[model samples]
Target: MKGNRHPKADIEAALKRAERAGLKVTRDQNGHRWGFVICCSCNREKLVWSTPASAGMEARRIDEFTRKHSNCA
Candidate 1:
């Protein structure tokens, strides 16, 4: 029941972390349950779900994405 619910603050914190890592973060146009993380240099983008279950893992995912695309033009 409660396992599927995510705390709003955790999701917000993850988005903030994404921004601090130099990624442009935007909430989905349709709702807050989804977000977009964009690479400022290459214009590459990734869709991230906003949820407490995934919040703690977002940083690592962002790091990997950045590293993989670091050489993009």
Candidate 2:
């Protein structure tokens, strides 16, 4: 995670992309800053933790995750 002044906005963008991809973003019980991205199509999920990094890094991470889990294993 790079230094990001506006991490939340970037995170929101990533979440939107995931939503468009048929994934759902949910806050995880691990903590307030932790979340889970679930692939509705395959029932696959990934856990993510937000940091004080740039939105670009967060978005990229999300893109990578979605790409990897786009299909069921």
Candidate 3:
């Protein structure tokens, strides 16, 4: 049920995981961190990208939802 990926953490972890997995990290033309283009081992692994807005909104929404549904979240 994990949604709205954590962006900054995603990049860091993606790089670490890629290196650990021996995958190559690549960047897009805009100097944006595109992370690992492909995972060399499984050939099916890919990055799950998410934005900070979505992540923050998701977290806040979940927090509010939980708070509304429970005594504490």
User: Which candidate number has the best TM-score?
Assistant: 2
Q: What global local distance difference test value does model 2 have?
A: 0.68
Q: Model 2, which residues run further than 4 Å from truth?
A: 1-7, 52-54, 71-73
Best-first order by lDDT? 2, 1, 3
Q: What is the lDDT of residue 6 in candidate 3?
A: 32
Q: Candidate 3: what lDDT? A: 0.39
How do all the candidates rank in terms of TM-score, highest first?
2, 1, 3
**Candidate 1 clash total?**
0
- Candidate 3 regions with alpha-carbon error over 4 angstroms: 1-7, 29-35, 41-73
Whichever of 1 and 2 has more lDDT, that candidate is 2
Residue 42 lDDT (model 3): 41
Over 6-32, each residue of candidate 2 has an lDDT whose tens digit, in order, gives 247777677777777778787654443
Pick by lDDT: which candidate is best?
2
Tens digit per residue, CA lDDT, model 1, 13-58: 6556666667777655434446577887888897776543656576
Clashing pairs in 3: none
lDDT (Cα, tens digit) per residue for candidate 3, span 1-73: 2332334553444444444544544443223323233444445333333343454453343333333333221
